[model samples]
Target: MEAYLAWVAIDLVIPNPMNPRRDHSIESEQMQEILRSKGWAEAITCYRKGQYYIILSGHRRWHAAKKMNEKEVPVYIVQAPENNAEELDRLGSIQGGQVDWTPYEWAKYTYDIWKNSGKASYSQLANKLGISQSLVGSRIRVYKFYPRIEIEDKLSNGMYSLSMLDYILKWIKRVEKHHFELYQSMGEELIRKQMLKKYENRCFNSKIAIDNIFVTSACSKDILEFLTDINKKLQDCQFELELLKVDNEVDVTQNKLNVKMIIDEIRLIECRTKNEAGNLKEELNKLLKEIELKENQLFDMVEN
Candidate 1:
């Protein structure tokens, strides 16, 4: 591959139509910041076509330069092949550095590579990416999540870690279609929050989690059902608290009645032994004061 650095006009280099990837990539602004701070670490890839140049990769960086009002930007010009389709497909494999492509981006363009090149085998893809077949297979499964655009923004924005993404994709595969669709509609962060709640044990068990997803995830049939479930839980908790309050009131009432009975018996004793009755009445008054304090506490609980 003949390659050389050339400062090309910003307007001359255009995004290739055949490049299968979403251009609403979240990395453009970050790249702009990086270019402003670090001043362009690597040259973008392009090939010449007559007078104009076409970009195979680095669309984000290219757009970032345009935003900065740059007339021309440096690019590594890879010699154009006669058959542009096959060559662009080949070059797509080597586009950008580590963290450039989102999982969805990979799925889209990798599908392009497969289709353009007449559908390569799994081992062929593994060999091309220099990874094991299983990793390639896992990435292919991630393609299924592409239909979920709400997640695309997050996934493209670097919202999830590799291992967490692995677990999420795994969960998507095993979960019921409707539930998974519901989860997809709920936004990525909410699902991530629920996943982390389950991942508190740090096991990342998708199979077991999927089995209990409805209960754990608060899945509901409709708005009425959701509200009904929440209201029912609240009512049950309130009922338990009310039972405790009732028990406390009953104990307090019984103590007050017993104190009354004691006072009556003491009055009768006073008729026979006045001095002993006086000491016993003083002790009974202290006991009655303690019970009154307990009753006040119960009142406070009710008021609150």
Candidate 2:
């Protein structure tokens, strides 16, 4: 096959109107807008054996160029091979290097080509694409199960990484028996609530453990009772202190009266015999005698 650039009017016919590659919606619209704005309506494709095949590397650009009604789009021609197998192999190689086609896209496209051409194996396709057989298998699996609209949106938005797509496909398949919206909403809500509850419980447990270590430990049932008792005692002590502060002179007077009242009460409650009371009286008399002696000595010095 020869590969060379050629103009649009090179005796080529647009073949296979039902070509799978021609189904462009998201990328095509963007391409058309861009070309209309920039006036760069030229695009590239592959031509072979009197048939023009559009290999959508830049599918949007091709669509835009077509929309502009441009008579001729630039292309690279590959001469037809001897057999269908060689032709498909050539097409797969060309598609393998094409841009805008993701791994999933390439996987689907390659699978279709091989299935149609009846010549390519999964291993061969994986080798040609420089991907693992398992990965190729996974891509094929996802292509079979994934929602087309979701996959297309993700692919266009650059959010469709292989791992994420794999996860989404697995999640969808697991919940396939359920209603789509119900399953989606339930999954999302469950994830959100689960994460939220996990963090909240962690924070609460950490706080409780810390408080037990550094502050005080109490059961939830006993905490209110303990706090109430402590608060009451504190309030009573505060009230007494406030009264004392408000009248310092009255506080002193009241303390003296309290001392006298305590002495009178002790005397009234005496249960000692007359002999014991006499012994106490004699001790008081001795103390008074000592005080008198000291006073007399002090007076004599002053007089002299």
Candidate 3:
């Protein structure tokens, strides 16, 4: 059937509720820019309701035209097979196959059509959409495991692709299935990065291995800090021990010199300088006590 080109009021073309696409911000902006430079050249597809129109495609263009305050939009109005759930499903599949639909978006739409169109009957429908039955099944598997949206624009948009969504789904399932308890709170993006890195390095074969590697990387920080602290303390103690050893050698040498001087003074003045020798002995005792105190402190540190 040939679609006739015509202009319709932008408000009359309603967005489909069955459409799984949540964010059209990027597309809308691009459309608005295109409208400014070239106007709405590519027509949106739609079908007539009694007083309004229902969109099968170009919801983003419709929205962008409205934002531009355009009174009407160019459309390819499919007049037949009008407004029913089944018809919506058919056109929706048509819409889903467009280049703009991300993997999750495609899967979500296909999964819906697959459910409502009846499973046994959807094989032909799948072929009509240029998609294989098993491919549709894989897409449905990807769709059913869709992750919770944190609603950040880029993250949320990127998550709709097959790889990211599949990783997140598998990550969560693997965590639960394999009992990787330590990684339950890790962010999806971080774990995804770790998986990609390990996969590239060929170091990890499974999600469990990925989780173990991530935990090891995380704990390596604490391990490094503990080692650093122990090394510093040991170095400080060794320096003190060396300092005390040097002090002990100086004390012994000084005492020997003092005793020799006292013997020379006794030989010349008949033991007149005995008090000087006693004073030198007292100084040596003080130095020895200081060394003993320092050694005790080092011992205490080691025991603790």
Candidate 4:
């Protein structure tokens, strides 16, 4: 349908809300503040084909205008579909030209609309709102995992970040599916301790590698801290492993030494060990060969 803009009088009895999209809490507060601070009122637009439909801008403003019991608010009327499906699809694409929302805000907004519409693609929804598809997907995933109470509290308090929500969702999923039994059996304290222990070990290993590569003024301090933390973790893991160890008599000292040597060789940059380094060495060699093949193909193309 051809789109045209027109102003419509504010009606209290107008049953259809401006947008079906909820999480309007943020928008409502923002619009109200803007209007009160500016000491001005503005026109809201509605799309009309047969019955009047609000479109484009002033969703929050329209609500505020209603609350204030204002008469004949100016509106830019545009032509839009009257049917539910078409109207929603159009809403998904339509830019209200309102203030730019943050990633979290946009995620929540887009997620609701997408959930309701069940027709908008991730790319289409994100593109319409000028956000990344991954972000849209991540938000939807977060919404799926997080309890409504937590999300509402976070969003309301403005303590929410998309990254934080992403992490929380991941943690929730991990706790729910993989660790639920363990979490229940071991209790929250023990689970937390194990998580912290694992994190410390990984951090220690990463830091050791980094320190070996780079030299800096604070390097000593970092290394000392990392070593201290990692040593504690190592002690814990060692104790745990010792508890689980089985009493078996096998002469494997030579084999253990060989494996350690192979691990050392993998850490080296220049050395290439094919036979001596075992499966890890073989995997590395294969990866290097694949990289070389790709490089050769690129070189040939350039030469041509």
> Judged by TM-score, which candidate is best?
3
Sort the predicted structures by lDDT, highest score first.
1, 3, 4, 2
List the pairs of residues colliding in candidate 3. Answer: none
| Descending-TM-score candidate ranking | 3, 1, 4, 2
**Lowest summed lDDT over 10 consecutive residues: which window, candidate 1?**
222-231
What are the per-residue Cα lDDT tens digits for candidate 3 across 1-304? 6779888888887876667676655567877998899966789888776877777788788888888888888888875463344775656666755646655566767777766666545567568567777667667666665342422233344523454444445644554444344344444454444444433343323343244323233233332232234222323333455676689899989988986886686466422488977886786689679769978997998999
Q: What is the alpha-carbon lDDT of model 3 when measured against the actual structure?
A: 0.60
Task: Compute the lDDT of residue 208 as modeled in candidate 4.
Answer: 27
Question: TM-score of every model?
Answer: 0.49, 0.41, 0.49, 0.47
Residue-level lDDT tens digits of model 2 in 1-304: 5578776652343532323353645466667777668765444556554445544234455555666677766776656556645555655565455545555566566556556556456788678667887777667666665556546555656645555455434433333333344446556445333322333233222222122211122222232232224222323333444565569878778978986985786577553699888887787689679769978997998998
Q: What would the per-residue lDDT of candidate 4 be over residues 224-293, giving only the tens digit for each residue?
A: 3433353444334334344434222133566568768867976774545765557666788897897699
Error of 3 at 157 (Å): 5.6
Name the candidate that leads on lDDT: 1
lDDT of 2: 0.52
Runs in model 4 lying further than 4 Å from the true structure: 1-9, 12-42, 48-56, 82-86, 89-96, 100-105, 112-129, 156-158, 180-304
TM-score, candidate number 4:
0.47
| Candidate 1, RMSD to the unseen true structure | 15.3
- For model 2, what is the alpha-carbon lDDT of residue 301? 84
In model 4, the clashing pairs are 5-77, 6-76, 6-77, 7-75, 43-74, 44-74, 44-75, 45-76
Tens-place lDDT digits, model 1, residues 108-127: 66565555556678789778
